[model samples]
Target chain A: MDAYEDLQQATLHDIPRSECLQLLGVARVGRIVFADDEGPVALPVNFRMDGESVLFRVSPASEMCLRLNEAKVSFQVDRLDDFHQTGWSVLVRGTSSYVESEDLPVLRSTRPLPWARGFRPVYVRVQPTQISGRRLVDD
Target chain B: MDAYEDLQQATLHDIPRSECLQLLGVARVGRIVFADDEGPVALPVNFRMDGESVLFRVSPASEMCLRLNEAKVSFQVDRLDDFHQTGWSVLVRGTSSYVESEDLPVLRSTRPLPWARGFRPVYVRVQPTQISGRRLVDD
Candidate 1:
Protein backbone atom coordinates (compact mmCIF):
# COMPACT_ATOMS: atom_id res chain seq x y z
CA MET A 1 0.00 0.00 0.00
CA ASP A 2 1.23 3.48 -0.82
CA ALA A 3 1.70 6.07 1.92
CA TYR A 4 -1.09 8.11 0.39
CA GLU A 5 -3.48 5.16 0.58
CA ASP A 6 -2.63 4.82 4.27
CA LEU A 7 -3.73 8.39 4.79
CA GLN A 8 -7.30 7.24 3.93
CA GLN A 9 -8.69 10.60 2.91
CA ALA A 10 -9.36 11.63 -0.66
CA THR A 11 -11.95 13.96 -2.17
CA LEU A 12 -13.31 13.21 -5.62
CA HIS A 13 -13.49 15.71 -8.40
CA ASP A 14 -16.10 15.41 -11.16
CA ILE A 15 -16.89 11.72 -11.61
CA PRO A 16 -18.16 10.43 -14.93
CA ARG A 17 -21.92 10.62 -15.40
CA SER A 18 -22.16 6.95 -16.30
CA GLU A 19 -20.42 5.99 -13.08
CA CYS A 20 -22.97 8.05 -11.23
CA LEU A 21 -25.81 6.23 -12.98
CA GLN A 22 -24.22 2.87 -12.26
CA LEU A 23 -23.91 3.74 -8.61
CA LEU A 24 -27.58 4.65 -8.58
CA GLY A 25 -28.35 1.42 -10.43
CA VAL A 26 -26.64 -0.72 -7.81
CA ALA A 27 -28.48 1.12 -5.09
CA ARG A 28 -32.02 -0.31 -5.26
CA VAL A 29 -32.88 1.68 -2.19
CA GLY A 30 -32.86 5.45 -1.59
CA ARG A 31 -34.86 8.23 -0.02
CA ILE A 32 -37.46 10.32 -1.84
CA VAL A 33 -37.98 13.85 -0.56
CA PHE A 34 -40.82 16.17 -1.36
CA ALA A 35 -42.78 19.08 0.06
CA ASP A 36 -46.31 19.06 1.42
CA ASP A 37 -48.48 21.96 2.51
CA GLU A 38 -47.33 21.25 6.04
CA GLY A 39 -43.58 20.87 5.36
CA PRO A 40 -40.99 18.62 3.70
CA VAL A 41 -41.22 14.85 3.97
CA ALA A 42 -38.71 12.14 3.13
CA LEU A 43 -39.45 8.46 2.61
CA PRO A 44 -37.48 5.37 1.63
CA VAL A 45 -38.19 3.81 -1.77
CA ASN A 46 -37.14 1.10 -4.23
CA PHE A 47 -36.09 2.44 -7.62
CA ARG A 48 -34.69 1.22 -10.94
CA MET A 49 -33.05 3.19 -13.70
CA ASP A 50 -34.92 3.66 -17.00
CA GLY A 51 -32.62 5.01 -19.64
CA GLU A 52 -32.26 8.67 -18.61
CA SER A 53 -35.11 8.47 -16.14
CA VAL A 54 -35.71 6.51 -12.93
CA LEU A 55 -38.85 4.47 -12.13
CA PHE A 56 -40.32 3.23 -8.86
CA ARG A 57 -43.55 1.90 -7.43
CA VAL A 58 -45.53 3.06 -4.45
CA SER A 59 -48.93 2.66 -2.88
CA PRO A 60 -51.52 5.38 -3.48
CA ALA A 61 -52.16 5.15 0.21
CA SER A 62 -48.59 6.35 0.64
CA GLU A 63 -48.53 10.09 1.13
CA MET A 64 -45.49 9.93 -1.15
CA CYS A 65 -47.74 9.44 -4.13
CA LEU A 66 -49.81 12.44 -3.13
CA ARG A 67 -46.74 14.71 -3.27
CA LEU A 68 -45.60 13.50 -6.70
CA ASN A 69 -47.91 15.47 -9.00
CA GLU A 70 -47.36 19.05 -7.90
CA ALA A 71 -44.12 19.21 -5.91
CA LYS A 72 -40.50 18.90 -7.04
CA VAL A 73 -38.85 15.86 -5.52
CA SER A 74 -35.41 14.39 -4.95
CA PHE A 75 -33.97 10.91 -4.71
CA GLN A 76 -30.65 10.19 -3.01
CA VAL A 77 -28.62 6.98 -2.88
CA ASP A 78 -25.35 6.54 -0.99
CA ARG A 79 -23.04 3.89 0.35
CA LEU A 80 -20.63 4.02 3.30
CA ASP A 81 -18.94 0.68 3.93
CA ASP A 82 -17.10 0.80 7.23
CA PHE A 83 -15.21 -2.36 6.28
CA HIS A 84 -13.60 -0.82 3.18
CA GLN A 85 -14.00 2.76 4.45
CA THR A 86 -15.02 3.87 0.96
CA GLY A 87 -18.26 5.55 -0.06
CA TRP A 88 -20.02 7.45 -2.82
CA SER A 89 -23.43 9.05 -3.32
CA VAL A 90 -25.72 10.20 -6.10
CA LEU A 91 -28.47 12.79 -5.80
CA VAL A 92 -31.29 13.14 -8.33
CA ARG A 93 -33.68 16.06 -8.62
CA GLY A 94 -36.76 15.96 -10.79
CA THR A 95 -40.50 16.24 -11.01
CA SER A 96 -42.54 13.04 -10.98
CA SER A 97 -45.37 11.62 -13.09
CA TYR A 98 -47.38 8.45 -12.90
CA VAL A 99 -46.16 5.65 -15.17
CA GLU A 100 -48.93 4.29 -17.32
CA SER A 101 -49.44 0.54 -17.11
CA GLU A 102 -48.64 0.21 -20.83
CA ASP A 103 -44.96 1.01 -20.19
CA LEU A 104 -44.27 -2.11 -18.14
CA PRO A 105 -42.44 -3.77 -21.04
CA VAL A 106 -39.75 -1.11 -21.10
CA LEU A 107 -39.69 -0.94 -17.31
CA ARG A 108 -39.16 -4.67 -16.68
CA SER A 109 -36.04 -4.93 -18.83
CA THR A 110 -33.71 -4.59 -15.85
CA ARG A 111 -35.60 -6.92 -13.46
CA PRO A 112 -33.53 -5.21 -10.75
CA LEU A 113 -35.44 -6.06 -7.63
CA PRO A 114 -33.81 -9.08 -5.96
CA TRP A 115 -36.08 -8.63 -2.97
CA ALA A 116 -39.49 -10.14 -2.47
CA ARG A 117 -42.16 -8.56 -4.61
CA GLY A 118 -44.89 -6.43 -3.11
CA PHE A 119 -48.39 -5.38 -4.23
CA ARG A 120 -48.94 -4.07 -7.74
CA PRO A 121 -46.47 -1.20 -7.37
CA VAL A 122 -48.06 2.10 -8.24
CA TYR A 123 -45.30 3.58 -10.44
CA VAL A 124 -43.74 7.06 -10.66
CA ARG A 125 -41.01 8.35 -12.94
CA VAL A 126 -38.32 10.88 -12.03
CA GLN A 127 -36.66 12.48 -15.05
CA PRO A 128 -33.45 14.10 -14.01
CA THR A 129 -32.57 17.61 -15.05
CA GLN A 130 -29.69 17.71 -12.56
CA ILE A 131 -27.55 14.72 -11.62
CA SER A 132 -24.42 14.79 -9.49
CA GLY A 133 -22.31 12.35 -7.51
CA ARG A 134 -19.42 12.42 -5.02
CA ARG A 135 -17.00 9.81 -3.78
CA LEU A 136 -14.63 9.50 -0.84
CA VAL A 137 -11.50 7.60 -1.80
CA ASP A 138 -8.42 6.40 0.08
CA ASP A 139 -5.52 8.77 -0.26
CA MET B 1 -47.49 -14.69 12.13
CA ASP B 2 -50.37 -12.90 13.79
CA ALA B 3 -53.49 -12.09 11.82
CA TYR B 4 -52.67 -8.40 11.91
CA GLU B 5 -49.24 -9.02 10.43
CA ASP B 6 -50.83 -11.28 7.86
CA LEU B 7 -53.82 -9.15 6.98
CA GLN B 8 -52.13 -6.13 5.44
CA GLN B 9 -48.73 -4.89 4.30
CA ALA B 10 -46.23 -4.12 7.08
CA THR B 11 -45.51 -0.42 7.19
CA LEU B 12 -43.47 2.03 9.29
CA HIS B 13 -45.73 2.18 12.30
CA ASP B 14 -45.78 -1.61 12.60
CA ILE B 15 -42.37 -1.60 14.21
CA PRO B 16 -41.74 -0.44 17.76
CA ARG B 17 -39.41 2.37 18.83
CA SER B 18 -36.82 0.09 20.48
CA GLU B 19 -36.59 -2.21 17.44
CA CYS B 20 -36.14 0.81 15.22
CA LEU B 21 -33.06 1.76 17.22
CA GLN B 22 -31.63 -1.70 16.68
CA LEU B 23 -31.91 -1.17 12.93
CA LEU B 24 -30.33 2.26 13.29
CA GLY B 25 -27.49 0.80 15.35
CA VAL B 26 -26.49 -1.70 12.67
CA ALA B 27 -27.03 0.69 9.75
CA ARG B 28 -23.73 2.57 10.30
CA VAL B 29 -24.79 4.97 7.57
CA GLY B 30 -27.46 7.54 6.75
CA ARG B 31 -28.14 11.14 5.73
CA ILE B 32 -29.09 14.26 7.65
CA VAL B 33 -31.41 16.91 6.21
CA PHE B 34 -32.29 20.39 7.35
CA ALA B 35 -33.90 23.48 5.87
CA ASP B 36 -32.08 26.75 5.44
CA ASP B 37 -32.16 29.88 3.34
CA GLU B 38 -31.71 27.84 0.18
CA GLY B 39 -34.27 25.15 1.09
CA PRO B 40 -33.84 21.55 2.21
CA VAL B 41 -30.46 19.86 1.82
CA ALA B 42 -29.56 16.27 2.65
CA LEU B 43 -26.02 15.13 3.38
CA PRO B 44 -24.76 11.65 4.10
CA VAL B 45 -22.98 10.84 7.38
CA ASN B 46 -21.52 8.00 9.41
CA PHE B 47 -23.45 7.85 12.67
CA ARG B 48 -23.92 5.94 15.91
CA MET B 49 -26.69 5.65 18.47
CA ASP B 50 -26.77 7.25 21.94
CA GLY B 51 -29.57 6.00 24.17
CA GLU B 52 -32.45 7.41 22.12
CA SER B 53 -30.32 9.94 20.28
CA VAL B 54 -28.27 9.61 17.09
CA LEU B 55 -24.77 11.12 17.15
CA PHE B 56 -22.35 11.63 14.31
CA ARG B 57 -19.31 13.66 13.35
CA VAL B 58 -19.60 16.62 11.05
CA SER B 59 -16.77 18.95 10.19
CA PRO B 60 -17.23 22.63 10.85
CA ALA B 61 -17.20 23.14 7.09
CA SER B 62 -20.26 20.97 6.64
CA GLU B 63 -23.25 22.92 5.38
CA MET B 64 -25.34 20.46 7.36
CA CYS B 65 -23.69 21.38 10.64
CA LEU B 66 -23.97 25.05 9.85
CA ARG B 67 -27.72 24.90 9.16
CA LEU B 68 -28.73 22.43 11.85
CA ASN B 69 -27.52 24.01 15.07
CA GLU B 70 -30.31 24.49 17.64
CA ALA B 71 -32.94 24.05 14.92
CA LYS B 72 -34.74 20.86 14.00
CA VAL B 73 -32.63 18.60 11.80
CA SER B 74 -33.86 15.32 10.45
CA PHE B 75 -31.51 12.35 10.78
CA GLN B 76 -32.20 9.21 8.73
CA VAL B 77 -30.63 5.72 8.94
CA ASP B 78 -31.53 2.85 6.60
CA ARG B 79 -30.05 -0.15 4.80
CA LEU B 80 -31.25 -2.39 1.94
CA ASP B 81 -30.34 -6.07 1.95
CA ASP B 82 -31.56 -7.47 -1.38
CA PHE B 83 -31.03 -11.07 -0.40
CA HIS B 84 -33.48 -11.21 2.48
CA GLN B 85 -35.71 -8.58 0.87
CA THR B 86 -36.14 -7.02 4.27
CA GLY B 87 -34.87 -3.81 5.82
CA TRP B 88 -35.94 -1.24 8.41
CA SER B 89 -35.37 2.50 8.68
CA VAL B 90 -35.49 5.16 11.36
CA LEU B 91 -35.96 8.93 11.13
CA VAL B 92 -35.34 11.29 13.99
CA ARG B 93 -36.18 14.99 14.05
CA GLY B 94 -34.03 16.77 16.54
CA THR B 95 -31.78 19.72 17.13
CA SER B 96 -28.05 19.22 16.51
CA SER B 97 -25.25 20.77 18.53
CA TYR B 98 -21.52 20.39 18.94
CA VAL B 99 -20.68 18.40 22.04
CA GLU B 100 -18.60 20.64 24.27
CA SER B 101 -15.05 19.53 25.08
CA GLU B 102 -15.84 19.51 28.79
CA ASP B 103 -18.66 17.03 28.16
CA LEU B 104 -16.25 14.41 26.77
CA PRO B 105 -16.37 12.34 29.93
CA VAL B 106 -20.14 11.97 29.79
CA LEU B 107 -20.06 11.22 26.04
CA ARG B 108 -17.36 8.60 26.54
CA SER B 109 -19.92 6.51 28.38
CA THR B 110 -21.92 6.53 25.12
CA ARG B 111 -18.80 5.23 23.29
CA PRO B 112 -18.34 8.22 21.01
CA LEU B 113 -16.05 7.85 18.00
CA PRO B 114 -12.34 7.16 18.43
CA TRP B 115 -11.84 10.34 16.47
CA ALA B 116 -8.28 11.03 17.68
CA ARG B 117 -6.89 7.90 16.01
CA GLY B 118 -7.63 9.22 12.57
CA PHE B 119 -9.79 12.15 11.52
CA ARG B 120 -10.50 14.49 14.38
CA PRO B 121 -14.26 14.16 14.02
CA VAL B 122 -16.45 17.06 15.08
CA TYR B 123 -19.04 15.64 17.43
CA VAL B 124 -22.65 16.40 16.45
CA ARG B 125 -25.41 15.53 18.84
CA VAL B 126 -29.03 15.08 17.64
CA GLN B 127 -31.54 15.05 20.44
CA PRO B 128 -34.77 13.81 18.87
CA THR B 129 -38.23 15.02 19.81
CA GLN B 130 -39.96 13.01 17.10
CA ILE B 131 -39.03 9.48 16.15
CA SER B 132 -40.63 7.45 13.34
CA GLY B 133 -39.75 4.24 11.53
CA ARG B 134 -40.80 1.96 8.65
CA ARG B 135 -40.21 -1.59 7.43
CA LEU B 136 -40.65 -3.67 4.29
CA VAL B 137 -42.42 -7.01 4.40
CA ASP B 138 -43.14 -9.47 1.61
CA ASP B 139 -46.08 -8.77 -0.66
Candidate 2:
Protein backbone atom coordinates (compact mmCIF):
# COMPACT_ATOMS: atom_id res chain seq x y z
CA MET A 1 0.00 0.00 0.00
CA ASP A 2 2.87 2.36 -0.71
CA ALA A 3 3.74 4.54 -3.69
CA TYR A 4 4.50 1.49 -5.84
CA GLU A 5 0.83 0.55 -5.99
CA ASP A 6 0.33 2.69 -9.04
CA LEU A 7 3.28 1.38 -10.96
CA GLN A 8 2.55 -0.04 -14.36
CA GLN A 9 5.26 -2.69 -14.42
CA ALA A 10 4.58 -4.49 -11.16
CA THR A 11 2.38 -4.51 -8.12
CA LEU A 12 3.00 -5.47 -4.54
CA HIS A 13 0.11 -7.31 -2.99
CA ASP A 14 -0.50 -7.93 0.68
CA ILE A 15 -0.86 -11.65 1.02
CA PRO A 16 -3.64 -12.97 3.21
CA ARG A 17 -2.80 -14.66 6.53
CA SER A 18 -4.18 -18.04 5.45
CA GLU A 19 -2.05 -18.05 2.31
CA CYS A 20 0.97 -16.92 4.27
CA LEU A 21 0.59 -19.90 6.59
CA GLN A 22 0.19 -22.15 3.59
CA LEU A 23 3.44 -20.83 2.10
CA LEU A 24 5.21 -21.22 5.43
CA GLY A 25 4.08 -24.80 5.64
CA VAL A 26 5.71 -25.60 2.34
CA ALA A 27 9.02 -23.77 2.90
CA ARG A 28 11.77 -25.59 4.77
CA VAL A 29 14.43 -22.88 5.24
CA GLY A 30 13.99 -19.44 6.69
CA ARG A 31 16.04 -16.76 8.40
CA ILE A 32 15.45 -16.01 12.04
CA VAL A 33 16.39 -12.51 13.16
CA PHE A 34 17.11 -11.68 16.77
CA ALA A 35 19.07 -9.14 18.76
CA ASP A 36 22.35 -10.20 20.30
CA ASP A 37 24.34 -7.95 22.63
CA GLU A 38 26.23 -6.55 19.66
CA GLY A 39 23.28 -6.08 17.30
CA PRO A 40 20.63 -7.90 15.29
CA VAL A 41 21.65 -11.14 13.59
CA ALA A 42 19.95 -13.24 10.92
CA LEU A 43 20.73 -16.91 10.47
CA PRO A 44 19.12 -19.38 8.09
CA VAL A 45 17.61 -22.46 9.69
CA ASN A 46 15.49 -25.37 8.63
CA PHE A 47 12.06 -24.83 10.14
CA ARG A 48 8.51 -26.18 10.15
CA MET A 49 5.14 -24.75 11.09
CA ASP A 50 3.28 -26.29 14.03
CA GLY A 51 -0.16 -24.75 13.71
CA GLU A 52 0.83 -21.07 13.80
CA SER A 53 4.16 -21.43 15.58
CA VAL A 54 7.54 -21.82 13.93
CA LEU A 55 9.66 -24.72 15.19
CA PHE A 56 13.37 -25.19 14.61
CA ARG A 57 16.23 -26.92 16.42
CA VAL A 58 19.69 -25.77 17.25
CA SER A 59 22.69 -27.02 19.15
CA PRO A 60 22.13 -26.57 22.86
CA ALA A 61 25.42 -24.74 23.36
CA SER A 62 25.19 -22.39 20.39
CA GLU A 63 24.66 -18.67 20.74
CA MET A 64 21.22 -18.92 19.12
CA CYS A 65 19.92 -21.18 21.84
CA LEU A 66 21.60 -19.14 24.55
CA ARG A 67 20.10 -15.79 23.46
CA LEU A 68 16.80 -16.76 21.86
CA ASN A 69 14.87 -17.96 24.90
CA GLU A 70 12.08 -15.56 25.89
CA ALA A 71 13.29 -13.08 23.31
CA LYS A 72 11.30 -11.15 20.68
CA VAL A 73 12.37 -12.32 17.26
CA SER A 74 11.38 -12.20 13.60
CA PHE A 75 11.33 -15.19 11.27
CA GLN A 76 11.31 -14.56 7.52
CA VAL A 77 10.80 -17.00 4.68
CA ASP A 78 10.87 -16.09 1.01
CA ARG A 79 11.23 -17.44 -2.50
CA LEU A 80 12.68 -15.15 -5.18
CA ASP A 81 13.31 -15.66 -8.85
CA ASP A 82 16.11 -13.33 -9.84
CA PHE A 83 15.45 -13.85 -13.53
CA HIS A 84 11.76 -13.00 -13.34
CA GLN A 85 12.17 -10.47 -10.54
CA THR A 86 9.20 -11.95 -8.72
CA GLY A 87 8.98 -13.24 -5.15
CA TRP A 88 6.92 -13.56 -2.01
CA SER A 89 8.11 -13.10 1.57
CA VAL A 90 6.44 -13.94 4.83
CA LEU A 91 7.41 -12.42 8.17
CA VAL A 92 6.53 -13.74 11.61
CA ARG A 93 7.14 -11.73 14.72
CA GLY A 94 6.94 -13.57 18.00
CA THR A 95 8.39 -14.57 21.32
CA SER A 96 10.77 -17.51 21.26
CA SER A 97 10.99 -20.18 23.96
CA TYR A 98 12.19 -23.70 24.44
CA VAL A 99 9.56 -26.32 23.70
CA GLU A 100 8.11 -27.71 26.90
CA SER A 101 8.96 -31.24 28.00
CA GLU A 102 5.30 -32.18 28.08
CA ASP A 103 4.82 -31.17 24.44
CA LEU A 104 8.09 -32.61 23.17
CA PRO A 105 6.58 -35.96 22.32
CA VAL A 106 3.85 -34.50 20.16
CA LEU A 107 6.20 -31.91 18.70
CA ARG A 108 8.72 -34.60 17.80
CA SER A 109 6.18 -36.19 15.55
CA THR A 110 6.31 -33.08 13.31
CA ARG A 111 9.86 -31.97 14.13
CA PRO A 112 11.99 -30.24 11.53
CA LEU A 113 15.26 -31.89 10.72
CA PRO A 114 18.09 -29.33 10.71
CA TRP A 115 20.06 -29.39 7.50
CA ALA A 116 23.39 -28.99 9.19
CA ARG A 117 24.85 -32.08 10.80
CA GLY A 118 24.97 -31.79 14.57
CA PHE A 119 23.32 -32.69 17.81
CA ARG A 120 20.43 -30.26 17.66
CA PRO A 121 18.80 -31.27 20.91
CA VAL A 122 17.27 -27.91 21.69
CA TYR A 123 13.82 -27.43 20.23
CA VAL A 124 12.85 -23.76 20.04
CA ARG A 125 9.34 -22.67 19.13
CA VAL A 126 8.36 -19.15 18.14
CA GLN A 127 4.78 -18.31 18.97
CA PRO A 128 3.68 -15.46 16.74
CA THR A 129 2.24 -12.15 17.83
CA GLN A 130 1.68 -11.06 14.22
CA ILE A 131 2.03 -12.68 10.83
CA SER A 132 2.07 -10.93 7.46
CA GLY A 133 3.36 -11.40 3.96
CA ARG A 134 3.78 -9.60 0.61
CA ARG A 135 4.19 -10.68 -2.97
CA LEU A 136 5.42 -8.73 -6.00
CA VAL A 137 4.10 -9.70 -9.40
CA ASP A 138 4.10 -8.40 -12.94
CA ASP A 139 1.07 -6.34 -13.79
CA MET B 1 33.61 -23.88 16.38
CA ASP B 2 30.88 -25.43 18.41
CA ALA B 3 29.99 -29.08 19.07
CA TYR B 4 29.47 -29.66 15.34
CA GLU B 5 33.18 -29.38 14.57
CA ASP B 6 33.68 -32.96 15.70
CA LEU B 7 30.73 -34.30 13.76
CA GLN B 8 31.56 -36.90 11.13
CA GLN B 9 28.76 -36.15 8.69
CA ALA B 10 29.21 -32.45 8.04
CA THR B 11 31.58 -29.65 8.94
CA LEU B 12 30.95 -25.96 9.39
CA HIS B 13 33.97 -24.06 8.17
CA ASP B 14 34.58 -20.41 8.93
CA ILE B 15 34.98 -18.65 5.62
CA PRO B 16 37.76 -16.05 5.55
CA ARG B 17 37.02 -12.36 5.01
CA SER B 18 38.41 -12.29 1.47
CA GLU B 19 36.21 -15.14 0.31
CA CYS B 20 33.20 -13.79 2.14
CA LEU B 21 33.52 -10.54 0.22
CA GLN B 22 33.90 -12.45 -2.98
CA LEU B 23 30.71 -14.35 -2.34
CA LEU B 24 28.87 -11.16 -1.47
CA GLY B 25 30.09 -9.60 -4.69
CA VAL B 26 28.39 -12.23 -6.82
CA ALA B 27 25.15 -12.54 -4.90
CA ARG B 28 22.44 -10.07 -5.98
CA VAL B 29 19.97 -10.51 -3.15
CA GLY B 30 20.23 -10.64 0.66
CA ARG B 31 18.29 -9.94 3.82
CA ILE B 32 18.90 -6.80 5.85
CA VAL B 33 18.01 -7.04 9.53
CA PHE B 34 17.52 -4.11 11.88
CA ALA B 35 15.62 -3.20 15.01
CA ASP B 36 12.23 -1.56 14.73
CA ASP B 37 10.13 -0.31 17.64
CA GLU B 38 8.36 -3.67 17.63
CA GLY B 39 11.50 -5.87 17.43
CA PRO B 40 13.93 -7.14 14.84
CA VAL B 41 12.87 -7.10 11.16
CA ALA B 42 14.37 -8.82 8.17
CA LEU B 43 13.61 -7.92 4.56
CA PRO B 44 15.12 -9.05 1.32
CA VAL B 45 17.04 -6.46 -0.70
CA ASN B 46 19.04 -6.32 -3.85
CA PHE B 47 22.52 -5.22 -2.86
CA ARG B 48 26.08 -4.96 -4.11
CA MET B 49 29.46 -4.53 -2.48
CA ASP B 50 31.18 -1.19 -2.84
CA GLY B 51 34.66 -1.79 -1.56
CA GLU B 52 33.88 -3.29 1.85
CA SER B 53 30.59 -1.50 2.26
CA VAL B 54 27.21 -2.94 1.25
CA LEU B 55 24.89 -0.65 -0.65
CA PHE B 56 21.21 -0.86 -1.59
CA ARG B 57 18.31 1.43 -2.34
CA VAL B 58 14.89 1.77 -0.81
CA SER B 59 11.92 4.03 -1.40
CA PRO B 60 12.39 7.33 0.37
CA ALA B 61 9.16 6.88 2.31
CA SER B 62 9.70 3.25 3.22
CA GLU B 63 10.17 2.17 6.82
CA MET B 64 13.64 0.96 5.99
CA CYS B 65 14.65 4.41 4.79
CA LEU B 66 13.13 6.04 7.86
CA ARG B 67 14.92 3.80 10.37
CA LEU B 68 18.12 2.70 8.66
CA ASN B 69 20.06 5.93 8.63
CA GLU B 70 22.99 5.80 11.06
CA ALA B 71 21.66 2.53 12.41
CA LYS B 72 23.45 -0.64 13.37
CA VAL B 73 22.23 -3.36 11.00
CA SER B 74 23.10 -6.84 9.88
CA PHE B 75 23.04 -7.94 6.23
CA GLN B 76 23.14 -11.62 5.34
CA VAL B 77 23.57 -13.42 2.01
CA ASP B 78 23.76 -17.14 1.39
CA ARG B 79 23.38 -19.91 -1.15
CA LEU B 80 21.96 -23.24 -0.06
CA ASP B 81 21.75 -26.53 -1.92
CA ASP B 82 18.93 -28.38 -0.22
CA PHE B 83 19.53 -31.70 -1.95
CA HIS B 84 23.24 -31.76 -1.15
CA GLN B 85 22.77 -30.12 2.28
CA THR B 86 25.71 -27.82 1.70
CA GLY B 87 25.75 -24.04 1.60
CA TRP B 88 27.61 -20.87 2.57
CA SER B 89 26.36 -17.82 4.40
CA VAL B 90 28.04 -14.44 4.79
CA LEU B 91 26.97 -11.93 7.41
CA VAL B 92 28.03 -8.30 7.55
CA ARG B 93 27.46 -6.19 10.63
CA GLY B 94 27.73 -2.46 10.18
CA THR B 95 26.45 1.07 10.58
CA SER B 96 24.18 2.46 7.84
CA SER B 97 23.97 5.95 6.45
CA TYR B 98 22.65 7.74 3.40
CA VAL B 99 25.02 8.16 0.50
CA GLU B 100 26.16 11.77 0.27
CA SER B 101 24.72 13.86 -2.58
CA GLU B 102 28.16 14.41 -4.02
CA ASP B 103 28.82 10.66 -4.19
CA LEU B 104 25.52 9.76 -5.87
CA PRO B 105 26.87 9.84 -9.42
CA VAL B 106 29.76 7.56 -8.58
CA LEU B 107 27.58 5.23 -6.58
CA ARG B 108 24.95 5.17 -9.29
CA SER B 109 27.54 3.73 -11.62
CA THR B 110 27.58 0.45 -9.74
CA ARG B 111 24.19 0.78 -8.12
CA PRO B 112 22.13 -2.35 -7.68
CA LEU B 113 18.87 -2.46 -9.56
CA PRO B 114 16.16 -3.59 -7.18
CA TRP B 115 14.16 -6.45 -8.61
CA ALA B 116 10.95 -5.17 -7.09
CA ARG B 117 9.80 -2.43 -9.38
CA GLY B 118 9.73 1.00 -7.83
CA PHE B 119 11.40 4.34 -7.87
CA ARG B 120 14.11 3.80 -5.28
CA PRO B 121 16.00 7.06 -4.97
CA VAL B 122 17.57 6.68 -1.54
CA TYR B 123 20.90 4.91 -1.48
CA VAL B 124 22.05 3.60 1.87
CA ARG B 125 25.55 2.36 2.56
CA VAL B 126 26.52 -0.03 5.32
CA GLN B 127 30.09 0.31 6.50
CA PRO B 128 31.04 -2.91 8.17
CA THR B 129 32.38 -3.14 11.68
CA GLN B 130 32.75 -6.87 11.29
CA ILE B 131 32.25 -9.36 8.47
CA SER B 132 32.10 -13.09 9.03
CA GLY B 133 30.87 -16.11 7.12
CA ARG B 134 30.45 -19.87 7.44
CA ARG B 135 30.18 -22.69 4.96
CA LEU B 136 28.58 -26.03 5.75
CA VAL B 137 30.31 -28.82 3.89
CA ASP B 138 30.15 -32.58 3.81
CA ASP B 139 32.89 -34.65 5.41
* DockQ top scorer: 2
- Error of model 1, residue A51, in angstroms: 2.1
> What tens-digit string does per-residue lDDT give for candidate 1 at B12-125?
435688787778777666787666553454667767787777777766665656776676667887766655557777777777777776654354544444211244356777
**Clashes by residue pair, model 2:** none
Looking at candidate 1 chain A, the ten consecutive residues that score lowest on lDDT are A1-10
The TM-score of candidate 2 is 0.90
Recovered native contacts, candidate 1: 0.08
DockQ of 1: 0.22
Best by TM-score: 2
TM-score (C-alpha) between model 1 and the true structure = 0.76
- What is the C-alpha lDDT profile of model 1 across A33-108, one tens digit per residue? 6665534446777678877677777767767678786446777877777766567778787777887778644535
Backbone clash pairs for candidate 1 read: A4-A139, B12-B134
List candidate 2 stretches off by more than 4 Å. Answer: A1-8, A105-109, B1-8, B105-109
DockQ per candidate: 0.22, 0.42
lDDT of 2 at A42: 96
Per-model TM-score versus the true fold:
0.76, 0.90
In terms of lDDT, model 2 sits at: 0.84
Q: Write the per-residue lDDT of candidate 2 for residues A1-139, one digit (tens) a residue.
A: 2343344365689999999999999888888899998889899887889899999888988998998899999999998766676789999999999987576537454677777776787889999999999998877
